[model samples]
Target: MSEMCPCGALLGESLMPREMAEEGIFSNLLEILMSASSEIEQACKDSNESVDLDTCLLLTAECFRCLRNACVECAKNQHVMRNLGLISTSVHLIKLLHGIQMKEELLLTALRCSLQFLGNIAAGNRDSQNSIWKCAFPDLFLTCLTYNDEKIVAYCCMILFTCLNSEKVRELLDPGNLTVAFHVLKVYKEQLESEWSFLIVTDHLLKCPELVKALYAKLSNQERVTLLELIMVNVNEKNPVTSEEVNVLMTHADFLAGCFQENCEAVLKLTSAADAEDEEALVTIRLLDVLCEMTSNNGQIEHLQSLPGLLETAIDTLRLTHIAGKQAVNIFTATHAMTGQEEISHPAVGFKSHLIRLIGNLCYKNKKNQDKVYELDGIPLILDNCSIDDNNPFVNQWAVYAIRNLTEHNERNQELIAQMEEKGLADNSALESMGLEIEKRDDKLILRSVRKKPS
Candidate 1:
């Protein structure tokens, strides 16, 4: 009988089975697997159209499985294990196993078998880590996220995160694949009820600062503005879905702060100068809130300096009776508290100037409220605030009385005197005749007696 051809195809009336018998059949299988691996690799190199390559890889994976089992079954054939080991050493075989659909148990089996043998050959000899492993199986991983397969998606995310740690692997990653993975994260961000999405994305983001920076750069200014607006809305909504939203915002605070600093002038110009009646003012307010929260983390003072007019704008906005001054104050106070530093290092400039201006305004208002304290609901609040103002006296006196229950120490009385002197305010002789003596100290002015006037 004529020998069968090994191509597995027929020409004319001749049926070519690639090879004959069990041994020849195994040899043909090995050849096909080798060729298939080569084609798959070429496909990877040429383009991302790996569907056909994947199908071929699947066939090769099955061949590995059949051959490995055959080797075990024919253990009596002493050469079987050696043949299996030889096949495993083929780089093409390893690539084939890696390229096959990871979802297939058979493919996974083949991978285990191949790795076990290849691991031995490459043992202690550092070979490049498997490059194919870094190719994100976007369709599979994303499907896992879409189907709410949290465990699998988490596992895949971890794998991808690790793979991305390698500069070489990261460079090899297809941008489209990266985008799909990111979209999976975004979908999880929008769809998942739990915070797994946030946790996973945040963990990944923390690993890749370059990725985060690139993402920020890739987003258009409008997109970034929208993201900031979204974060602000979530943070300030009546009730947040989860504290995770706030935590995520905080995690990216530095990035958010940079963006805010870059676009602050534009933002302020748009919002501050916009018609007060326009809805954009609300957007501006939200943006400000985000900026405030971003800066609420450590190093905020340095971050704040990057924004040219942010402090002035904040101070101006807070001074407005229309804006939420209390809220603004709370934000500033939180920022200051976090940094353990003053809002302005120079109490003689910037916020201090604004604060002094505010004190003057409050003092003027307090004079108007003096006779109408009972009728003016803001009297107590004004009195409380005035006590802290270093530029007001009439207000400080009432403020001191309001807090008299808290401290009997001369500090409070002395503070009042210092404030008066700082503002060039002096006691009226009418009150002095009733006995009040104001003494000036190097750092402060002190009230010494009720009956003496400074000569």
Candidate 2:
């Protein structure tokens, strides 16, 4: 009873989170803000030359810090603070911070606190969240992210993730915010909070078709590929038909398939400036993973099979290749055989194997893709990979299985393999020349035997 009384309360209860953020506390904070605002305004007018407004910046930052502390747990405090016009004031402070000449410490600190203050005000308050949207906060925060200071960029990620929770914020950011948000997810995902903030926002966007359409229109080719990788990891459907995002994504009309096609071109240009990191194999693997996931559905197989150059891209990726000195080299890549010491197959081998499986899956019941695979010179490549014990054995096993799948009932492919076999004996066959044998399995043309598991 004594503790509940305001006068005789325990110190912990003296200021209910609400009382600690009382109108009087707000008034004092507002006074400090007003003082800092005037000083910043004066400095802005006095200096056209960029010079640090050391005292002015610190005071403005401290004002935001105080308000942030006060509003930490109290929803009404956020409401009251935003109603007091602090949202606009924080925006102005951000503008001032961007404009003023300042030391790195002061500028970074001011930006962090000012943005943090905006985020705090947005907590659980729809009107305050919308207030942030109406202001230039998103654009400003995105701009700060490109400055390449990881800490500062990370704070921007946190702020954007926090404030952009409401539908109002999504309406304003929709497609465009995805570009900034995903860039952070791609580059700074490791640095984000335990929640994986970037992915959370992106997953939300993917669920909304309108949001994804906007994202599709705004992202660059590389960014699109990066986003595609995240999407692949996200839409991990064991039974893909049951998934909403995947179903919605499929409705986008070759949107994802086109992304895969572009990713292949990007990988093919492994030496081009366009593929700076030479992440070709990695991106190639990501595309294959997504395709495999999509093809798992009986409905999606035909759709992916129909994407021109998509299956062909998978076929092209199956070739044994390596990156050497900024050039993509076609190599025997017989790691263990050549080194006289067993070495692991390059990751490209595994990715190539995944591509074979994807194409194989696409051809499951789709004759057009089977024909397309046949036309893409896929027969020779498929047979060449039939018994590769030197590198990854699964590459050989999946290749053999793919050949079986491709030729399951397709007479045209069967005929092509038979002709290739006849030619193999007449001349040094592409298969025999490479020292691989072609065997006829009752109704199938395949390697006599493949290492079913890794060698």
Which candidate tops lDDT?
2
Q: What TM-score fits each model? A: 0.35, 0.69
Candidate 2 residue pairs in backbone clash: none
| Model 1 weakest 10-residue run by lDDT | 120-129
Those runs of model 1 whose alpha carbons end farther than 4 Å from true positions after fitting are: 1-130, 134-155, 166-181, 191-200, 207-210, 217-255, 261-307, 316-455
Worst 10 residues of 2 by lDDT: 1-10
Q: For model 1, which pairs clash?
A: 5-18, 6-18, 7-18, 435-450, 435-451, 436-450
Per-residue lDDT of model 2, residues 1-455, tens digit only: 32431111233443476555567677777777777767777778876644346776777777777776656546778878877878877777677667765556877777777766666666567677678777755577667666545655655555566556536336645555565655554554445452434545454555555665576557555555566655665655333456664567576436656666666644444334444346554555566667777776666666666767777767766653332311432322323354546665443445556667887887887788888888788877766655544444467567656777787778787667766776662232433433335566676665332333333
lDDT of 1 by residue, 118-171 (tens): 222222222211322322244434443443334434433433443333353244
Q: Quick one: RMSD of model 2? A: 7.4
